[model samples]
Target: MTTSTLILPGSPEWLRYFSASKVAALPIKLDERGEYTRGVSRWESPFSLFHRMAGHLEPEDPKDEFTVGHAAELMLAALYRELHPGWRLSPGEVQYVRTDLGVPAMATLDRRASRGSSRRVVEFKTARDANEFGVDGTDEIPADYFIQQTWQMGVTGYTRHPAHLMLGMSFFARRLFEVAFDAEVFAFLLEAARKFNAMLAEGIEPELDDTKPTYETIRELHPDIDGTAVYIEAADAQALLDSEADLDAAKSFAMGRKSWALKQMGNAQYLYVRDPGGDHKKDVKVADRRKNSHGSVSFYVNKKADLAAITGGIS
Candidate 1:
């Protein structure tokens, strides 16, 4: 979608859901970044810095969405190949699955039904810890995660043998999986969707009690989205996980540092910030210091000079 026709062009509306991004950036769990970023444009205090730091406490990669989601999707495609070996993998599946929602994370897919001729509805476990699955082959799937994929199946109108699979297994050691259908899951999806739609109507995104809402919360609320927590057990699963883990770890480490990018917006030539390791860096924005040198994890935009290019160049 183009930026010109957006309902909430939050990239420029920095004053509504305002906060400071001058210290460390803390990504809000909800879709409030638009509102928050707009607000951050005018603040002038340490609190602004603090809020910015907190909002960007996690990593924000400079890579585009396709670059990021494509890697995960590619993994899923490979998993489908392993499970059904040459069983005509549908590009339509990608189109349907790429289906995301305006609410973000609550995406839906227009998939084929899992009824008579359908084998099962498979899901992938890109990230599974060591002790998640059972050893003796008793099929141990995390109920919450199972609910999510099952919910999607329910949304796609599948009633027969619905299963959630993992692409990676034998703990994080391996990375692939398969599954059979369950009726209990489909019923759960219907109820969850009913409630989730209501929350969206109220402009309320589901968030945890202690910490702010993360994207996980957004996906879980979808009634048609039962969760999946399967083990990763493919032959190449561990290798795949190792390769991706390094990338993910770097992103995770970068989050707190990126929050400090907000301080660059200030007119203060000498900006102070709390570095990711929790150390204060008085010389962070000094002259001749290249950006990546300090290892930033946030999107750096000058409120005065760079706000236009920050988001969609809204206002």
Candidate 2:
């Protein structure tokens, strides 16, 4: 079966049911909020989400693009089945309900039961044939897809989690990856969805995202406006200055540390810091120092989190 559109061409019942296709669309009313915005789609931008939540008019995407994308998603689903044997993937049956946040929501899978009876959801994504693989391993999904898959899990009651497959059509290669369910993220999404719906119910407008589209939208909203000046609180001006100063200081501090590290390994392409052990060999920290093709020097540091540590501060 083919995927359904959230804003299907139908009667009022259509508004109550949301499909994955409309995740990016701006929300129109409280009744339609969950169907449009609840799922974790890359379309969930701060600006777009706010507009959707506040029932503001969103910039329209080209009809051609929308149709092409939908077609691509369907084709990818077929390709997935052909590529992976024993996977019972099918278009999801959409169900509309009042979510815990008290807003209408739905989760429709592009293909379900990706890997056996696990009931795992599979999200198919198609990228430009020219785009390079994001991670070193072909099994890793990009950040956006991870969020999308997790969101799918959140709404589908698939606490087992979701798998994502990205297809680069130019090469006809597919990358399969899985994301663990995050309770915190799911809870946050529900709360945020509720808050946005509440804003719509209360007739409150959300702040616009600082983006070109929003700028254009603002211009259109105030088109042919007579010139006028608005007053701001002195505290706002002071806060801006303070923030700039703090950023400048952080930049200088980071630059100094980078330079110092570079100088310490002047002739070497890598630096190894040895932490000597009392009764064993030293534990070494390796950092890469290399020159790019453009003659620009680059440094690599281990930025991964230390799970053993109590705090997020660098160890």
Candidate 3:
């Protein structure tokens, strides 16, 4: 019997398998449940996979209806089903699939959709605006989300998986993008999972990355600092000191540039960029200076600024 047939989805046996969504972000020496299990087996869900991969000591807390993003997901899924004809959307029951390296994995899709013989794995997401989802002008999705969907497609055995994104808090704006399963990416992920499991078996910790989750994990690992002194290699001590000096120099340089920009924008509330097209001239606001009631001034650049359109003269 195959691994999938051996362990039924959602069963106690299934809980021992690694989740496809968490495979990419699963930290070294950490169990599937975000707890240290050493040589024991554990399980993980898609909801907290991103945090787990980042070496966070704790998984993400459950979200409720009060969370805007979670609420938008529910609204978008329902509205999409109502608007589209012949499309049946149902909760994706847990699915089990094994990686090429023989790593048992499972996934629970956001929505399993079907139209006659055509089937798809649907994922719903919400952002403050279209820009966040790259629906405004670009074609980029977050790397973590892309990996999660790819893993889901592998488990569901679907060729097409589409993302349903809702922009803002309302259901007025929405966009859909079709994604295809990538065998090469899946193979790479499988190898990564194999390596992680190997490290877990040996109880080896992975090196830390420059992420907040990793930093927080380091802090949690040493909560109470005793007055005992530990000796470090001379080379390691020099490297740490050099890194601190570089960081301080970079900060000073950034402050100098900020001061120069503020001096150039003296007395001007807004900085405008003029783009000339044929006989027409279009003016776009690139940056603005605002003064609050507390008498403190702040400067900000327009995050939605069109860089291509503003490549002309600035005034």
Candidate 4:
């Protein structure tokens, strides 16, 4: 889903991080220590950028990019309105999006202690569509996404579920596919978060533990879970079919549970952070370029794990 590195230019992680925060109307809560935790401080998501260009209604001979983009956005906004009644969004927030993840992280989630309150996180994604662009169709999120979503849950202590995965999607020709939250995926994420947090406390950052059958155990124990994390599927796939609607019908292509595509606006628009040869940027890293870029909020890396490896920033 949003976690995939298949995005146009930036790392898949960077793209998803920024896109979700930008489109979301609500503000992301600061980390436990009050450090800002949102991803990407600039640029609209590819889908969001195009969607805005399409506007409320379609224009004759609309840019295919804008039409498609607008349709996707309109549908999602409408879906959010339907699913989260109290949830709010601010359209202009995209103007100042940032992804500092707070030098080092202000705080990390604690796995052992019981967490209180409902926590939520969102991620965004767009693919080549069913129209065919190599081998791009996927109904499932990459394993990394599960970990990333879970990390948010772990970090924020939302719902006491350990983690939650909110998947959003917009395929070129196919309607958007949205899956609000996958409990199973969250469980895996929670475990990962739990382990990662534990490692952080111990001055370590847990890597994908090949020693354990990571996902298998999670799947087996999923039904036994009862956490409060709330996942709102932003799309109503059935709406498009039953209403005989157009692309304006919002559905989430990102989340697997829902499917929607804006009716083709002739003028769909698409954009990239680097509009025609812009400067390049890199993810927050663990100092020495010789080492892998680990322990960053974008990757839910542990604070103390790579403390020595880090030349700058603090958690």
Candidate 5:
């Protein structure tokens, strides 16, 4: 198969290519026309990739307000141009299809830019707050975004790329992080994609992950219950019961610890952990309690805690 790079993103021709954004229908049915026949695309985040290969339906997009992601998509190119001097930026999406792998794969890069002889694949992202980017005043790219960008680099044959992360709806904070392509990790991702394609061809479903998305997908898969009961292996049934008990115990344990912490907090709005003889200025803030407009109190831990010092690297 020859690589195709001419198809525009979201075009009818592009729809024929496999995309993680497209919802997979349930009952193990695949669209005969497009998705089932095409190769995987870099548009897949790890979560969506797993769901796609597992034959799980993608969740419906929320209909409420315009999302941060939507804003980021619309503004990424313009922002990139404004931030980087002497770089020539392209406006449209750059698509790539690689046919050399065991399973052919494709990707759609958000924008491409060049400075002299240097070229880069650029991706854009948005976060609710700075804490999501990092707690210790550093930008940490999320794993899924890393994988997506790395996949894009692999597909486009770019050695390095930069991901621009925007914080908040107002675009209050912006940070650019560049990533280098990793041959070993990209090889692993390719192998995984190949196996996923195999599973799809063999009509096998991937094992479910313990995630809300998976739970929601399962719920959507069987919306109406038939009056039939299915048999389960005794060990599987026992495991389910054990999991339920474990969840309850974990909840109770967490609640008890929280109650004790709250009691220790007393009338203080913030809780701290300090050295035996340390000054207030040197104290480590642990958690804080705040009252909302509804007259209800909420407690949350400090995101900047040095977990390695606290847990001795156990976690």
Candidate 6:
């Protein structure tokens, strides 16, 4: 379909219900007929499909930077045309490809490349820093992009995947990684999607990650009730108590170290520690950086920046 035919999500209001991306994220376990499918986006977590099945799905916010990524892609496409004269980058539709489990999957190419019948998938990305794309020239695509681009290729039946990333917020630094589609990874994602979907259909909630956001999401879903109590395994209860005790002990030890450091500093606001074996080496500095109104002491490690000098490489 042409870009003109495509109705951007949240544009006309009614398109939200039938958004291809949204349909692809439905609980896989419930799709017995295997109709709904979607290509994974770059920013989405690998377990996003499973998350959808677990009833934790949230609408993609239009304000998200990924939403701006499309505009960036358009600009990049124009620049790429100037750099590579013969290549054509345009949108192409790939109808749903059936996975081994009979599920229909689809991929919306960011931009399809065609030069004399040779087609390639061009993935455009904007990263916060170069590190997100990994050390330059290593050809290492980050795991999230790997999962996303590979799925796009699998759906499009393309073997060549050319990913171009604009590194950093400045958008000046650039990195291009030529990633090959991996059959093993494609098979794994397909199977994983099916398995997670099945689990969700069976009324099983996905295991929560140890992150504050996940905790907050759960809390929002099920807030405190009026004198409600839930039962847990005795071992689980004991584990929580043990963790609490360990945390308290760790906190006490840390506080003790701070107290000792403060005593050693006395009138000075900083503490310097030297290596016992050598006097020539630089000392480690613990600086009293800032203070709050509550009279809390904040310590900061002052280290010299010598990455290039130390490694004989550019910083």
CA RMSD, predictions in order: 22.2, 8.6, 8.3, 26.3, 7.7, 9.7
List residue ranges in candidate 3 displaced over 4 A. Answer: 1-17, 26-60, 63-67, 91-101, 129-132, 136-139, 160-172, 248-315
Candidate 4 similarity to native, TM-score: 0.25
Q: Could you tell me which 10 consecutive residues in candidate 1 have the lowest summed lDDT?
A: 17-26
Best to worst by TM-score, what's the order?
5, 3, 6, 2, 1, 4
Looking at model 3, residue 51 earns an lDDT score of: 31
Model 5 spans > 4 angstroms off? 1-59, 62-66, 73-79, 132-139, 160-171, 233-235, 262-272, 275-285, 288-297, 302-306, 310-315
Global lDDT scores for all candidate models:
0.37, 0.55, 0.59, 0.32, 0.59, 0.55
Candidate 2 structure quality by residue, lDDT tens digits, 69-88: 67777767777677667777
Residue 205, model 1: lDDT of 34
Model 2 lDDT vs. the true structure? Answer: 0.55
Off by over 4 Å in 1: 1-69, 72-83, 95-116, 135-139, 169-179, 202-208, 212-315
Off by over 4 Å in 2: 1-44, 58-62, 91-98, 114-118, 129-133, 136-142, 223-315
CA lDDT, candidate 4, residue 244: 55
Model 2: what TM-score?
0.54
Candidate 4 stretches with Cα past 4 Å from truth are 1-75, 89-103, 106-118, 130-139, 160-315
- Give TM per candidate: 0.36, 0.54, 0.64, 0.25, 0.68, 0.58
> TM-score of predicted model 5?
0.68
| Candidate 4 Cα RMSD after full superposition onto the native fold (Å) | 26.3
Best by TM-score: 5
Whose lDDT is higher: candidate 4's or candidate 5's?
5
lDDT of 6 by residue, 46-100 (tens): 2443443344555446776876776777666666567568888775432333334
Tens digits of per-residue lDDT, candidate 4, 33-135, equal: 6742321223222222222222311222546764564455544555544555654443311211223432111112111122233434433334432221122
Residue 245, candidate 2: C-alpha displacement in angstroms = 20
* lDDT of candidate model 5 versus the reference: 0.59
In the range 97-187, model 1's lDDT, one tens digit per residue, is: 1123321212122122233366345554444233345432334554444444554544444446544454353323444333345667444
